[model samples]
Structures are given as structure tokens and as C-alpha cells.
Target: MTASRISNTTGWLSFAGVVAFVVGVFNVMDGLVALFRNDYYQVTSQDILVFNFTAWGWIWLILGLAQIAIGAGLLAEQSWARTAGVAMAVLVAIGQLAFLRAFPVWSVLVIAMCVLLVYALTAHPRTRAYPEA
Candidate 1:
């Protein structure tokens, strides 16, 4: 007999994906503002990090797209979305950590969300909800 399916909310992975989706939406808005305004500049030194505004624009756009795709896929209980979502979230986290100066609050938030996303994706219930292809 098929094992009974549990609720998607039974674990952190699902929650993480949800968080990623929300954060992604926020990033999209932030990115669009930065891209359109042309007021994106900050102090820089050998120790501080900064992203090229133009390149960052594209990065934000691509990452946002991926985040949405992964979130939607997970919500739909798609297998690939689980892994992709986790991967993208991790990247976002690392990128944030590396560039914390440019976006202190946002970077920290993304990093925190990344950790939670990893936990959620690795959680047992979430794994079961999205079986491998």
C-alpha cells in the first residue's frame, strides 16, 4: 500500500521555500529601484565589498526569476524545485554574506533565510512531499 502522505507544513523545508519566495519578491523590488534610480553607490575599500550596479541589476533579475520558479515548483510539490530552491537560497545567502556592506539588513536577512531554507529543504516531511524525478 502507498504510504500515507503528510501535510506539507509538517516540516521546515516547505517553510523555507515559502520564506525564500517572500524574500525574492522583496529583492525584486529593491533591485528594480536600484536599477532604475542610478543612485546605487557606497563607500568601498580593500575590505569592503561592492557590486557593479549594472551587473547587480542582472544578477537580481536572474536570481529573482529563479527564486520564483523554485518557490512555485515547491508549492506545486515538484521534485526538482526542492533541490533548486535550496541551491538558489544557499547562493543568495553566500552572496549576501560576501556583500554585507552594500545591503546590511537585506544581506543579513537573506543569509538567515538561507539557513532556514536549507533546514526546511532537508527536513524529512518536505523530502517526502517532493519525491525525486
Candidate 2:
């Protein structure tokens, strides 16, 4: 890869990392509230598009943790982070869809970010990994 492409890849990965970290924090909080204060969602488990609040809470918690770890790994340039970032970002987007009814705007925003993360991770494979000598 050219020097500029290498730099661009790193730039995109860095952006993915930062954005994932921020979004993960929100997911974590959302998970906690869902677990503890189910009423906060203002909708019963049945009302949700998918699983119950408790189940959803655990899902969000676990996914959020995964996102945080992926973000950190990307920042550290771990070899596995690129694939993980793409996978996790896709999951996050799907998860957000389930969350749409509860937080329409936030869910849409998160989905958008996830798409960007996916793009950043997939734009160039060689750049995502160690460049050829």
C-alpha cells in the first residue's frame, strides 16, 4: 500500500475505535438501566421488538463490552481488531434495530456509526493489517 493509503487506513481505524468507545458507553448504560429499572424503557418486555428487557439487558451488556474491547484493540493495532470491528459493528447495527422503538433517534445514529465502522474496517484489507515489506 502507498503511504497515503496506510495513513488513511489508520485514520479510519482510529475513528472506528473512538466512536465505538463512545457508543459502547451508552450501550452499557442502557443495559444497566434495562436490567435494573425496566420501567425506564416505558415499555413492557412484550412491547419490545425482540427479547424481554432482562434478556435484552444482558445482550446489550455483553455486546457493549465486546465493542469496548474491539475499540481498544483497534487503537492498539491488534491484528484481530479489524475483523472483530466489522463483525461487532454489524451486530451493533442489528441490535440498534431492535432498540428502534425505544430510542428512535439514538438507534438510527448508532446504526449509521456502525455502517461507517464497517466501511472503515473493510475499505482496504492490506492497510488493516501489517503492510507488505
- RMSD list, candidates in order: 6.5, 6.0
For each candidate, what TM-score against the reference?
A: 0.75, 0.82
lDDT of 1 by residue, 42-118 (tens): 63333335566555666776787778778777777778888888788888877667667766877787788778877
TM-score between candidate 2 and the true structure: 0.82
Q: Which stretches of candidate 2 lie over 4 Å from their true place?
A: 1-9, 125-133
State how far residue 80 of model 1 sits from its true place (Å). 0.2
- Give the range where candidate 2 is weakest over 10 consecutive residues by summed lDDT: 1-10
Clashes found in each candidate (C-alpha, N, C closer than 3 A): 3, 0
Candidate 1, residue 79: how far the Cα is off, in Å: 0.2
lDDT of 2 by residue, 62-114 (tens): 98898899889888888798898888888889998988887678789889988
The CA lDDT of each predicted structure is 0.71, 0.82
Candidate 2 residue 61 C-alpha distance from true site, Å = 0.5
